[model samples]
Structures are given as C-alpha cells and as structure tokens.
Target: MQKKMIKKIRKRDTKGLDYVINNYSKKVYYLVDKIIGFYGREEVEECVSDVFYELWENIDQFDEKRGEFSSFIYMKTKYKALDYKRRLEKKEVHKTELEDDITNKITTEHIVLDKESSEEIIEIINNFKEPDKTYFYNRYFMYYKVDDIAVMYKTTRASVENRLYRCRLKIKEMLEGRK
Candidate 1:
C-alpha cells in the first residue's frame, strides 16, 4: 500500500497525492516548527507548506527502507530552515561582522568529523530533545560562539559551554561504539 501510494504520487494521481497530504500535513507542520521554532504562526504554516511542495517535487527520490517517513520529512524541513537562515544572513547589512565571526570560529574550533562520521554524529545528537539539540546545532553547525549561544538560549556562557562539551563527547562516544 505504501509503495502503491508512492507510485501513484509519482504518476501524478491527484487522489493518492491528496491522501498522502491529508495524512501527513499536521506531522509536517509540527516537524517544521520543531526545527525552526515559532517565528510567527503564519511563517510556521508557510514553512510547512514549503516542505510539502519540496516533498512533492522530490517524492520520487525517496527511498522507503533507508529511513522512517517522519525522519525524511524532518530532514527536509531541517534543510529548508537552514537555507532560510542562510538567506537571512545574506541580507544582513552587517556582513563584515558576520564574516569576521565566521573567520574567528573557523580558526578556533575544529570540526571533528568527516562526512560519514558527521552522519553518525547527527544520529547521536538526534537522541537529544528541545534545547539540547537546538543548542548543539547552534553551537556547532551554525558556528555560534559560546557567548552567542548563551544569548540565544538565554543561559550563561559557562552553561552553554558545558552542554556543548558534553554533547561533543557524547557524539564521539557514539561514533566510537559504531566501530
């Protein structure tokens, strides 16, 4: 049934498409909100709709056995939110400061993982909830410094640093276990 639905959607069968959309719309919206947070209710709605359009556009590329459907949708929303964040950064008038920050972070902290290792790192990080995952991504992938992460997370720099240090150690352990 799942394969048939996917096939129908790929063939442009409207009814099958509608069935999938109707079933998955709320899940997609919740997933997007989880990734991007509540900017505003309307923006949240649009982001979810954007995810669906992306999913529909690329539905044929989905591989069922590789991941859960929810995970696939979550990843799609996550990438979209990251792209939106980059767009906002590009629009900033304070580009020099941003560039300087990027330079400083790159010169300071190291990215410990290669491509395959990074995926394993993500799997470990996904085990965290709420502010933990948010904090980890902001600190590492987005390269926000401890002070910046503290401001965003409304915590002290020491606390943010501790969480990041532990999260990194946890990810390293998880990757080691995979060996």
Candidate 2:
C-alpha cells in the first residue's frame, strides 16, 4: 500500500499524497508529540503539515533498496521536529539576551545588595543539584520564564515552579542561618 502510494507520489499524483497523509497522519502526530510536546497543539499540527510538505518536496530522494516508506517518513518527522525545536531555542536565546539587557539596566538602578551577599547567593546556587542548579541559573541568572524552563527540560510548568520554590526556600534558610 505504502510503496504504491510512494510510487504515485513520485509520479506527482496528488491522490497518493492524500492517501499517505490519511493513512499516516496519526503516526506522524505521535512522533511529533513525543519530540516536541511542550509546544502548543497548533505548532505541533504545523510541524505535521511541514513533515508532509517535506515528503512531497523530497519524494525523489526515497530509495526502495535502502529502506521502507514508513522509515523514511519517520526519519523526516523526527528531523523536522528537531529543526523546529532548534529554531525556537535560537529565538528564545535572542529574546532572552535583549530582555536581560533592559532588565539589567533597570535592576542595577534600583537593587542594592552588598557584594558579599551577592557572592554568598551565587555560591549557594552553585551547590544545588543537577536540574535544580540548572533551573536556578535559567530562572534567576538567565531570566527565563517557568514555561520556557519546562519546555527546555521537557517537563510540566507546575513541576518547574514547585522545584524552584523548594530551591528558594532552601536558599532562604541557608541565608537566614548565616545571619
């Protein structure tokens, strides 16, 4: 069935493309969800459509001697999802840098913690465990939102918020103990 569809697609038959989409959209959606579930449904759907577009555009690249049609589509979906993820990451990085610049300007004018206290806080953050340290650095030092951190770690926003809360409590206790 798939091979016939692939052949027809290679022949520029639109029906074959429709048939492939009808038969394989669910599997493609599942793969996209697994790779980029942190994104909204609209974005995931867009990625699915992009996968089909890629398959349509590169139909000639499919070689029967190399592998099955399903494998080809699966690889295409994975790569497209990864590409989307990379694009989002780059956008987030640029946005973060710009926001940090503006924020630092405002914060430097208002905030006045002593250098010793700032050093102590940095030391405390450095001692945190794997993802807690990463979460703290991303949230406080890098100024990322909880949603972005959740997406970056492929976890829920609530989980990121809870962990950050716990880390903050620990830092508070450590600081209070010093005083």
lDDT (C-alpha, whole model) for all candidates: 0.71, 0.84
| Model 2 Cα lDDT, one tens digit per residue, 39-109 | 67887999999999999999998899999888999999999999998887888887985785466535432
In candidate 1, the residue pairs with backbone N, CA or C atoms under 3 Å apart (3 or more residues apart, or in different chains) clash, namely none
Best by lDDT: 2
Candidate 2, TM-score vs. the true structure? 0.58
* Candidate closest to the true structure, highest TM-score: 2
lDDT of 1 at 121: 61
Clashes of 1: 0
**Residue-level error in angstroms, candidate 2, position 31:** 0.9
| RMSD to true structure for each model, in Å | 19.1, 10.0
After superposing candidate 1 on the true structure, give the runs of residues whose Cα lies further than 4 Å from its correct spot. Answer: 89-179
